[model samples]
Target: MSQTETNRRLITELQSRGLRLLDESAGAPSRRGGAGPSDHKAVQINGQTVMVPVHSRSAAVSPFEAGASGANGAVQLTRDGAHVGDIRFPEAPRFYGLQTLDGVPYWKIAQLHGTDVLATTVLQTCVRYGRRDTSCQFCAIGESLAAGRTINRKLPEHLAEVARAAVRMDGVRHMVMTTGTPNFTDRGAALLCESAFAVRAAVDIPIQAQCEPPDDPVWFDRLKAAGVDSLGMHLEAVTPEVRARIMPGKAEADVEQYMAAFADAVAVFGRGQVSTYILAGLGDSASAILETSERLIALGVYPFVVPFVPVGGTPLAEHPPPDAAFMRSILQPLGRMLAEAGLRARDIKAGCGRCGACSSLSTYED
Candidate 1:
């Protein structure tokens, strides 16, 4: 295979099966349980940093394992006991060591994602998270909060402080501010606005704010005015049946509602600036995912389709991740669709898709 295809295949398999670290010291500090990309550590392979699951059940028995660290922390990757290639872990960000004047640690407010993107959940508690019946089966939004690794609510100013420090100390390129849906008509848009406004005022960092579609479409304009460079309204599942089965409460908004919101959002954020998260293995057929992605691309929405990683401590913790073949079936075609529509993830100002670390879809976008 060509180099790009080789890297794409390797990343897809690693994300699906997870990576087992044979030498504990070989890897950098990984995100344990948090809002985005939990149970993963950022691994740079062939100059691309992608989040690889290292703490999931599948990881413990993964055929792909990393051996002892070499110079500059590069480790040998072996698949089925055969050496594959070398990968390196991103070192912990310097901002992780600082704290707010009130004694809140900076790391809790915003943690490093992949190599340089700073990420955090502005509101750690979700209205639906407390109940299994209402929550997304794959979510672990409350795990970090319950474990005391992060606070319940990150005040706007506090988030700003950390964002500024992260930029200055670690050269953080962009910021991702997601929220647990709040119990309001605006969902969590108001909180994200406040947080994004503060961060923008504090620094010149590009920001992407993610939340459920607000009750009013005007909030999209408000979000753009607040310095949110990009917008994400995630449709974790596409079809009605899968939406209700996987994320019952969020499904109430429905795919139709999200489509309307995406149109409104695209008007404000421009093409490729508005995006959505699509989990590929959540009972949605590969054709269903590609069909949805085609619609999204037509509407200027980037469908960031990622293989679902079953995070520990959630309802789907033991659920099997989508195998590499299934993911390849979805991503390979979706990447072409994205290219045809001129909706490249790299063109996205900021967000999960722009980061392109959670999934190997970006690798196939060429």
Candidate 2:
């Protein structure tokens, strides 16, 4: 195929498999994506949900074919967006080179997100992860735990050790530390703060931390004071029914708790710094997700919408991802709302939004 033909085929193939460019412009919310209420192609390949172009039917091709990327589609060409060259992976920085005298792999502890940001989940196991009624259906938090890939929790000092190495050794510019829920009064937020403060003392990299909204909104201020520059309070689903079904334990907090937490986070982290994830295809409608997003934007919080990609071996294992067209439909209206609020994903200082990986919301915003 000609290079242009090869590129077009590559885009079609990737879209057929639910992948798209991460940065916005051509396949934007209002453009060719499903956000328009127009029919977009969908298929089940090997039982996984995929969003195909309306005219094509196939699985994904290698990302190397076009200027597209593997993680987020940052370089996919769309008609309206800026024609920036493809965004490429940041090289493994020097910090990934060093290890403590103990010989624990530094990259294994925490790794860079996207190009330059360091991200780690210090505590990777959730209390009710495997239990039938307590786990978040969408989370694979304990998948690595089951395979002995990570410890249930890492000590503040251990986390600090890796954080320092990542900064001084790697060209890492920002940091994000997250944890599974701990059965403590601090709800694991306190431990994240301790680690953040330690990393701050060692390097000048800004940090972002995520956790379940603590029992008290006051903890948001505590995290900010402890050198955490941004916050991610994830509400994976929008409606209460979906939340309860997908994340029974998290749903226990109630929507009111989440709203209150968002208000508190905005107060401490400022507008555009606070973020929440709202997964698509989880039994909620496009209107429902966008309506919630609109309300969130009004309160200076970002609705980081993502397509529900069913990770292997979770309770939702048998479940399928939402078709890509549905994700496009939801993102279009919501992206507009976010744009009007001036809540560009890049404006998020740290975490998933800034990395622009894990979801296509950033592309929609484009």
Say which candidate scores most in TM-score: 1
lDDT by residue for model 1 (1-366), tens: 798889899999999999998776554578778789999989999899999999999999999999888877789999999999999988788888889999999888888998879998999989998898999899998898889889989999999999888889989999999999997599999999889999999999999999999999999989988999999999999999999999988899889989999999999999999999999888999999999889999999999999999998998999899999999999999988888888898998898999999999988889
Question: Residue-wise lDDT of candidate 2 within 1-366, one digit each (tens)?
Answer: 575433333332344243333432222121121111111222222222223323212112212222344465344333234342342323345776677677766665776554466767877766777586888876777655566544566666667788777666666677778888876466788888888887777667778898888878788888998988888888888898999898888888887788888988898899989888787778998988888888888889888776565555566644655665676677667767777778997777777677654455555564
Candidates in order, TM-scores: namely 0.98, 0.76
Of candidate 1, the 10-residue stretch with the lowest lDDT total is: 22-31
Alpha-carbon local distance difference test for all models = 0.91, 0.64
- Listed per candidate, the RMSD to the true structure in angstroms reads 1.0, 9.4
RMSD of 1: 1.0
